[model samples]
Target: MRLMTIFIALLGSVAVPGLAADVGFEEVKITNGAEPPLTAGIWYPTNAQGTSHSLGDFTQTVAPEAPIAGSRLPLVVMSHGGGGWYGSHYDTALALAHAGFVAAAVSHAGDTFDDQSRVLQLWRRPEQLHRLISYMLDEWRWHRRLDAARIGAFGFSNGGFTVLVAAGGVPDLSKIAPFCDVHADHDLCDALQHAGVERHFGSNVPASAWIHDSRIRAVVIAAPSFGFAFGRAGLSSVRTAVQIWSAADDRHQPHPYYDEPVRDDLPRAPGYHVVANAGHFDFLPPCDARLSRMRPEICNSRPGFDRATFHDQFNADVLQSLHDTLP
Candidate 1:
């Protein structure tokens, strides 16, 4: 009875009204040459009303297998952070879905939770995202219903780095060792301490590998990693409108080294937001009780801070940027 009561309470907590129009959900798979099949979730506008659909311990207010709403819609491609899944930002995806946009998130083949083989390989990220976009535009079932030219990207953490490359930014692996030497205490430095990144990855990547996709017209990214790698020259190449969000107290990647450089160096004026007293994980969707128990470090916030409330505004700002830029 106690367990049942707890389950009921958790259910009620996440049962809030969704934004704008109703959302439809579907699971899609894209086969990209020899790489593992890319599993993605697509959220889009739908005329059918939605009901709560439970997946594992979490639930989303969506109509599963519902028909598409309009003939052609703007597309938003999402890339999750390191060790993160595509649904890490479901609320954001839902917001885009309700706002008459088709939002799809591809699970980066070797960087996701199930696979971490290539998490340290920085170049593979943009390449994988490129293939994902190509498949979505050229081969996905809904290709005919999508407005090819009106496309944008959303990313978080390392995924943030991926979209920037997709938007024409280049990264220099040479900068990492020097950055780690100075900030050895940082999480990024500690993670690479044992990897021998210089000998293996440094010499392999070409100085001018083309990673940009002209199809992506706008981009929104949060707490991007390897910011110093882009420097000014690499970032200046990015011509698309960008919106960047930062957590005031991010411990993992931290500021100045991560989000600051992008703000200072990008030639294009970017829409920036800094959430006071919030941590890095606060940028992720609010936690349910089950998730709170499973990952308290990320689920808990400062005494007065609320992740859900912040996301309401965060989602709105992102939608406005994409709508304004992509249109």
Candidate 2:
């Protein structure tokens, strides 16, 4: 593993710098009058050199608040999974920045690691992302540096469900109870029990809550939860191109339950990839020592799997997919 990590670093030197220059990093508190300030992290290309810096437990080479280097750069708004934060896909964000795109990830309020109060309220997620895109294109300090027409989205797990809706797919949440009743052995059912979520999570959510933004030209979704809910009819309206990913051995949001339905139901054929020997949480980056100790479940891959190596290809593929659609 140590040797593989060294190899990954070496590859970064050769694999990075894909369509742009050095990477810049920064955080923002988006304050729109209609909602509480949102916490977000952004990565973009820069002409300035960046030094290795610690952001909480993780470290990355980033030019902090460096001057914007590119004009009208492509923008990608990221939505993290339930109980995840903006940094959940930090490595991917950095890769996007290195590839000349501005990547912004939001710590979905009330559904983040620090709070799960709105975890079951899936309808609000796409709306949150919509607001995020609006803030980036209209209010962000670097708003003028972005190209609104080339906007895209990337999401994982719950976030997967989110970007799909934002791209005009509607999920029939009413399918939850019936599905759960039959698949009671699934981890999603167990998670719901621990989180105290009622099966009636779909009730009373007006159609208006599922906001759709046609501006998101493309999306990349990984192991989306609640996939069954997006039946053929529900996913019929999604015209935006998409790239879908699934872990072959995912234990959490397992097969035919999560990624399958979306892949099968989407009106347009999506670019899909399933990683062999990968688990559900393997979609996250290779964990740091401290993070591994704290959450080994999400950190460790199967005996033979190498996450650091896989993410190299993963990031490149994600980058290519975005550029193909957004450009």
**Highest lDDT model number:** 2
| Tens digit of per-residue lDDT, candidate 1, span 85-129 | 778788888877876788999888788877888887777777778
Worst 10 residues of 1 by lDDT: 1-10
Candidate 2 least-lDDT 10 residues = 1-10
RMSD of 2: 3.4
Highest TM-score model number:
2
Task: State each model's CA lDDT, in order.
Answer: 0.81, 0.86
Q: Candidate 1's C-alpha lDDT?
A: 0.81
C-alpha displacement of 209 in model 2, angstroms? 1.2
Model 1 clashes, total count: 0
TM-score of 2: 0.93
lDDT of 2 by residue, 1-327 (tens): 332243345444443323445688899987645778888999998888989998756888889999877787889999988889999999889888877789999988889988877778788788778888988898888899898899999999999999999999888787888888998888888787777788767966666779999999999999998899889999999999999999999998879789999999999999999999999998998987889999898888898999998898888788778877886
Residue 179 lDDT (model 2): 87
